[model samples]
Target chain A: MVPVFLAQWMKEKRSPYMVLIFISISIAAALLFGSNMDIKLKIDTFRGEGVTVEEAERWIDRLNESGAFIFSLRAEEESLADVRQGRSDMAVRLLKDDYRIIAVMESTNVELVQQHMQAVYHEEFRIMAAASHAEDELEFREAMKTYMEQPPLKLQSSTSSGSELRSYDMRLQLLFGFSLFLAMLTVGFRVNAMTAEKISGIWNRVILSPLTKTEMYLGHLTYSTLIGIVQITMVFLLAKYLFGFSLGHSFGMLAMIVVLYTMTIVAMSMLFTGILRTPEQFGAIFTSIVPIMPLISGAYMPPGTITNDVLLFIGQFLPLQHALDALIGVSIYEQGWTDIYLPLAKLLLMAVIFFGVGINLVERRRL
Target chain B: MLETVELSKSFKGKTVVDGVSLYLDQGESVGLLGPNGAGKSTTISMISSLLAPTHGDVLLRGKSVIKHPQDIRRVLGVVPQEIALYEELSAYENLQFFGRIYKLKKTALESKIQEVLEIVGLRERQKELIKTFSGGMKRRINIAAALLHNPQIVIMDEPTVGIDPQSRNHILDTVRYLNLEKGTTVLYTSHYMEEVEQLCKRMYIMDHGKVIASGTKEELGRILSSEDTILLQLDAYDDAFIEEIRSLDPVRQVERTDQGLKLIIAKQSRVLSSIVQSAERHSVQLINMHVHTPSLEDVFLHLTGRTLRD
Candidate 1:
């Protein structure tokens, strides 16, 4: 078993494919991080009719209360120039009779910013038209500001510790939440290699040796587990240094959850290896399945945002969801062992089942 | 010693290797010869214990290999027809990996790898990745990989296929050297009948999943002793003309070709006049002709009614 494991490592260390995979994962992490870091929602505003700088500032202040965007007032040309130059995220040119929005048509981020800016300005436009007097217009604006300022929902504490939930950057939250997805990418690579070996002529020679079926499965699985851990660990290290993302007081506990989650991923890799007939088959299956995991598991959304009970219930069973929950709970909420035991235990139980079934299937099948 | 007892294998109720039995004495090189899809590889695989045989048993030194495969694994090395190597790794690294799998430790493994590299003449550039090497060079390293642990029996399944002549010759010489100098038994399978004739003292010729003939090289050649093969090249010929040639006096059989025909004759001189008369009657113009001594190919063609490489 040791020799087989060592041989697997030696092949990876010597192969250019290994280097290519490392660079790809790093670039993927950096790209995901960069996309998150560079997005700043800026809502540029201008005065129109009775809409003075002071009145516009009031609306800007109202939007700023959410802390979800950067609000400012700029000239029509200057602000539109910023939009053209890709500096300011969005701009609005207000006239005596009507207002025009300026933004890049292509970017999805710009589209979202445009929608948010429209909601606020459209409300102001409606009130000013309905108000018939100067004081009435100002009074209506004030009422609308207060209405916007009101909290979306009443606050409540679900946990006993009463930890203040910090509002997270949506992209940053997803980047961390996808730690399992990112780790599984490397596991996918190892599974590809296993399929390649099985098809190659070397398999016959290796089978001629005295190695047992259990040893072969365990050897490849162990290597995959190590690779998953190492790749995920590298992403975390890069996050800490490059993004200043902290893992909080329970870093060790967080690391344990990641390792256990990685175990489940490795077992899944084995299961894929056992079921798929070829490397291309695994790749096709993986490409189809990879996006669906993060999609259905809510890795792309903020916690408490998955309002659908079915999605949340399904998330309970996904290892990625549990991993993200445990990571966020321990790192942001400063959760202790007792607080994280359920997810950790669920991940472990899934790991045992996956590994057990994977080994049993691979043993019975020639692959 | 390795012995296969009526080894047979079937897929979907169709037999690929049927009730074939053979043996390899210690330090002897035995060859399994057959055309493509004739079950040479299947037989070798079953013998190496890589594939399970249906309704058959294999014995290694009188111990049942089917029930206990590891008993022979310690002594058997298989070189499959396709390149069974990690092209990403260097030859030395590939050898070292296999040595470790064979349970060779430290100095023993290192020295054996170096020894095989020297033997296969890849020692100077052992550090280069196998993918960088030519087809023949890769084949040499493939064989070298099987020699690392110094197994008693080396099973080669067409290792020389698609290689340059020099590399093919080198592999043949190395197999011979291993048998003669190291006293390692070899079970060699091939498409090239000449290779088997040159390498093995005893050989089996197979087709359609069964050994059609098995004997020493000279003994196998005797199957063609009574008949002489006449190859006639022609300017023009057809199937009807071939049938006319087949009806010639003293002609046992006639196989059509691109030019003319291959006729098996009982007495060449007596049939020459009749063959010429038949060619004239069919208006088939003979360009060139040759008669040669019987070879293993003739034996295969005699028994299986097809070329060894067909």
Candidate 2:
């Protein structure tokens, strides 16, 4: 049975398809990283000449104390893409009197940069007034100060788009969810294939043999988990080596969680097969369910952003949410076993429930 | 020995197999004969424990298999009507997988796989993937996969349904070898009467979920002893010729077909010559003729008023 599974996996390898998925992820990551780099360079240049690190640090400290980091400028009005492309950190207005503070990033991490901009604001404005009386320096400064003081209730920040935590560890939540997805498909497809054989008559050969249902189920689950572990470990290696992601949380603990999660998925698949009699039905159900998973999983999108009350409610019952939460703790916070015990316990509890429900459903078919 | 006592099953409110009783002793061969929708597969499924009988019981070695299915399932091999081998795996790989399932240890399992592959005459092509195999090869491997464990009682459900004559003959020879040479009890099912007549010693005729008749080949054939079969090939067949053939001496009934006419006669030899004589008188050319003694197909036609193929 074990060899059969290995042979089966070898037959399904289709290495080229996997390579395509990997290439797509790499390309997406590179594009996002490049865009971030271009924005970083533009902000640096806007800080202007000979702004010493010490002066920047002092200015940043003041801005941090004041809890404000504002950017205001004026240029020929054009597309939002152009405003962003020139790598301007905020929206810029080139009014006759003064520029408007359309965007602000609260000084949380880079306070010194905010301070350097504030220090040179008045000097830059005065130099512009000397060249042309098209703008009043005092009035322009006052307008800019008022704008910064009020700073429109909502502020858009560049840091918000990326992983907000500087540590690579926090992204483990995404990796964990991805691992769960892999486990779901692997185990589910195997179970689907096996059940299809049962319905289509191949199982008769095995049924009359010494192999009991327990052995068949165990053999498949064991092989599926092994495959899942390999896939997950590869994703982690890629993250660590190629993408610089963290995985310092106890590998043992993560393995334990992953095993439970894999079992849960396997059990869920069994339940699905029991409910849906044919492979076509299974395919339909799997497709319908897979797209909705990432939302509950908080893999590509966080559960917090999901405003639909029903989806949020459903998210709590979903295995992905608990697994993702545990992942965030273990990877992001570098949490110890003590910190993760609660979420891990919940996951195990849910796993038990799913297993019970699934087994009951499948076994009931015997009647 | 394998037996089903009053075995019954229903699906979605329709009784698919009702009150079917059958028994096969050691080394005995039985064929199940029935038209389509006659519940042959359903009965086999119940005996194999692949299905739960709505009522009654199936037994192996005097122990009720429904109560202890694993005991029977361990020794009973079934070749389904459909090809059941995995197309993704090669013939050898499929046999090994099933061999392991039957808990054959490494050394013995290897020897047994070689043995079965040789028996099936596919030893040289064992490594070829099933998906790449021809239809006949696939059918042969399908049967070979079922024989890996050397089962005591083997049930083949319409195994020769859609195979070339050569493969069909190979399968029939294998069945004969398994039953006669190896003392394996066999339960075979098919709609084809000739295969059943060629292979089965005892047989059962089923229709609409009921076993209408069961006996030895001769005994079942004897059920319609009063009526013998006559075949007549003619240049053309018409209602008048059919009526004239029925009115002939010893002719009990007549059925006309495009090729010729079938006359069920009380005395087949007495009427066969007269039918040819009458065909010439009616300006009908007698192309060929035969007197078919009462066989399973006659018994099926007698019981159902429809041929097995119908």
Candidate 3:
């Protein structure tokens, strides 16, 4: 089977268009994993009239720990000029002895620096009350606990990873998805071609040759699968290297998933062959099914976002979706085999179903 | 030797090939001649093991190929009516593809590709894509691909359709060469009567999905020996004139050709005077006239009362 597939691959060779797509995908994948951002700590002294002294001190400490720290001055006596003149990374002005946390990081670092300050302040307060006076500490702890318990009025931090479940940018994945779709397309068309050859005049030429149906089927089937695999591999490697796309799964696992997905594609192609009479008819059939398949199977979006119950169920049935979900699961959650079993199982089952249908469609009939 | 025993096929409850029983001895060339939609293609499909006959069996070398068509398929070659060569690939690539499918050994397959390319007179153009080739060139390459596997029995289904006269003659010569020189059994199917008349020693005439007639051309010629054809040309004529001519006593059958009128007369007819008398009575300006022996076209006309095209 390997030799047959390889032989067919060498015979067809890759078209130039395919080579271009591969090169592009590799560049794109490399871009995803290479973006970087920097952050620093600081403090501010322009406290609003509503601020209290302890709140100001706590804010200042948080800045000292997580933000770029400059200098502090007493509100009544210390000169702001001395603090500003090369004394610190940032200058703080004490207003009524209350402070505000501020930072002068590059715009890219500002948000990250602010996020760290807030987290650090919250932690420091808990520690400070734990070490200070007992009865006062108890009272202070209760008050501080209540204050800490109060959710911030506007707690918007884009850098807070917990705020958003990070999803890999799907455009890159969709490219690979399209490759799988193309594989299925190839299979569908090839089936019609084979059927036409079988019934028309060419079957005699085919059969009289030493070629067996299995060999012919495999030869074409291998070409289709390899086309898909090559496209997928090219896209996958690009997404992996260019995008910094933590593919989150082992290379071997991803390869296995691609193989299963391609097998299912072959099966679907066979089904089309069995049902359609001509290449044009197969194209029509393929168009009718393929567009809907990507939509239902969550090829472009998360499965949970797909609204239709039937479509969702069907998506779960599609090996491509299952494989993608399993890949994402491994990548995002750092899941291992135990967590992957269900999607893997579903993929295998779908593969079997597809193969069975394809065999039934393609096997020579009695009459 | 290969043979089909009472092989029949029906589609959608209509029989297409009904009770076709024929055999070919090794190296013997047989032709299947039929009018359009005459089950010739369908029969060859079954005989090639591509389609299963609804009933009966195909026997190759005394073994039933119906249940095990694969065994028969191995030594049988088919050239279909439609051009089946891939337009995207070069001639050599296409042949190489077919070669790989046939499971030729790697070295032998390469050599066979080179050999078939030479035989088809396209070795220099082997690298040129088939889509770029002329219709005749593609046809030759199509035949060459079939020849690559060196099958014992070669089946060509209307192989010369729409080809230039030169290419058609070339294909005919190559087929004859393969059969006579290489000792390969040939099954040729064509709607063209002349191709069959010139090439096939044995012929089968199919109609409405059944073998209505089968024999040597001489044997089939005997079927219409009782009647002979006479063609009459006129510089001027009218329907009334043809009507009067059809009423002539010696005319067994009458039909109009483009330039003149045709008649089938009894074999013993000596009706030149009667024909001239009818022409004179009708005031038809007679230009030319001829009497000729019956042909396969006449035989088909006698059998179905229609032209082979119909």
In terms of DockQ, the best-performing candidate is 1
Stretches of candidate 3 off by over 4 Å are A1-11, A14-204, A302-304, A364-367, B67-71, B233-244, B256-258, B268-287
Scored by TM-score, the top model is: 1
Better candidate by TM-score, 1 or 2: 1
Per-residue lDDT value at A253 in model 1: 87
Docking class of 1: medium
Best by lDDT: 1
- Please give each candidate's TM-score: 0.85, 0.77, 0.74
Q: Give the DockQ of candidate 3.
A: 0.27
Least accurate stretch of 10 residues (summed lDDT) in model 2 chain A? A40-49
**lDDT tens per residue, model 1, A324-360:** 8788778777788898889888888888887788667
Q: Evaluate residue B122 in candidate 2 and report its C-alpha lDDT on the 0 to 100 scale.
A: 93
Looking at model 1, how many pairs of residues clash? 0
Q: What DockQ, on C-alphas, does every prediction get?
A: 0.63, 0.55, 0.27
- Candidate 3 recovers what fraction of true contacts? 0.50
lDDT of 2 by residue, A1-367 (tens): 6644654565456233543354345334433543343342222221224544454444334333432343322233432445457444444332322223333454322344434444555555564665466366677656766787888786543223243444343235555555556556666776777667766676666666666677666666566556655655666667667776666547777767666666666666767777876788888988689657766655654335567877778877776677767766666655667777877777778767766776677666642
**Residue range A302-348, candidate 3, lDDT tens digits:** 34667888887777766667767766665555556777788888767
Tens-digit lDDT string for candidate 1 (B257-294)? 66667777775457777767777887888788877766
Give the Cα error of residue B49 in candidate 1, in Å.
Answer: 1.8
Two-chain DockQ for model 1: 0.63
